[model samples]
Target: METIAFFNLKGGVGKTTSAVNIAWHAANEGIPTLLWDLDPQGAASWLLDSKAKSKAQPKKILNGKTPIGNLVKPTNYQHLDIIPADFSIRDLEQQLQLQSEQGQRNLIAKLIEPFSENYALIILDCPPSFSLLSEQIFDTADALYLPLIPTHLSLRTFEQTRDFFKKNKLKPKRLHAFFTMVDRRRSLHRLMLAHPPKMLKNGLPTPIPYAAVVERMGDHQAPLPAFDRNAHVSKAYASLWQDIKATLSDF
Candidate 1:
């Protein structure tokens, strides 16, 4: 299975929203998809209306104490399942630190290996941090989708991610990025959309507009396309999924 992670060092950049939408779209396309909530906050889990039992934590699976498949919970959507996150993930770094260098690097890959036979795509909703957990994600994900705002600060974070990969001699199969919370009326947003950073490998041409619908995800507890498929935000996410599908030809 191909694993894709929605990650960013800076929080509040629409990472969880993007992940939920993309995973929903993937499942709508008949792909057996699993959305794995890796963030300690469990925002993605709540968004999909899925919950993990108190005893179900990623730490056990990573440490080889629990079977990955057994921890998965089916979501409300068809062809889509989820492995919800729990607060125990806050100590994930400490757990990884206790392992050997090889184990630290390969822990995530090993956890997901057994699920390859069941899922065609696995989407990871990651937390906002640059730590051992991020390193594990970098090693595990086939494609890294970075949700960035059209601002200088966001570009700086993107550069930091690239430098981290370069410094660590890591190369993910694909790196996709796109602007989120865009306002067409704003000059800066217009400028960034007109001329995106040349350094980025690929970017979705459509930008997810700043809309109340997108912000109301917590209240809706469902993906944008699930309730309001006609909304502009939903259309933007659709375009993004199409672009991503074309780029990830193997999908």
Candidate 2:
């Protein structure tokens, strides 16, 4: 499976929404897709109408006490399954640290490897932070997709991600980025889009517009496309998914 993570060091950047929408699009294309919500907040799970509680603690899976297969739960959509997040995931970093010493972060990779061929794509909706758990995600993923706001601070965080990869000797394979919540009326937003940051290898061609329809995802409890396929934001996500698939081909 092509494992891609939607992540940002800073929160409120539309990471979870983008992950959910993109996974829907992938499944709609007849590709078996799995959305793994790694955020402790459980926003993705709730968005898919799944219960917020999970019987299996993600910590156990990370500690090698439970099988990763047991964590898989089918969502309402066809060919789309979710490994929902639980509150116990808040201790994921501590669990990893306790399981092994330094440089033994392959536990996540080992967990995911067995099921690599079972699905066409795996989307990880990661928590917002720079932590030990994030390091493990970097170890497990084939690509990292950062949903950033068009701002100077967001550019700084993107730089930090690049620096972390360099310091850890990780190849930035398929490192893709796109701007979320873009307000074209704002001069700063327009200027940032006009003069793209050098840190992004190939910026996604479409920017998710700042719209109330996007924010109403919580009320709909489904992907933007599922409710209104013709909505501007939904169409944007569909186009974004196409761009993402093309980038993943390079991997």
Candidate 1 per-residue lDDT, tens place, 25-105, comes to 999999999998989889999999988876675666667888878789999999999988863765666677777455445
Q: Between which residue pairs do clashes occur in model 1? A: none
Candidate 1 overall lDDT versus native? 0.85
Candidate 1 lDDT at 97 equals 72
Q: Model 2, stretches more than 4 Å misplaced?
A: 52-54, 57-60, 102-105
lDDT of every predicted structure (CA atoms): 0.85, 0.84
C-alpha displacement of 205 in model 2, angstroms? 1.6
Which has the greatest lDDT? 1
Q: Which regions of candidate 1 are displaced past 4 Å?
A: 55-59, 101-105
What is candidate 2's lDDT per residue for 7-33, written digit by digit as tens?
889998999999999999999998999
TM-scores of the models, in the order given: 0.94, 0.93
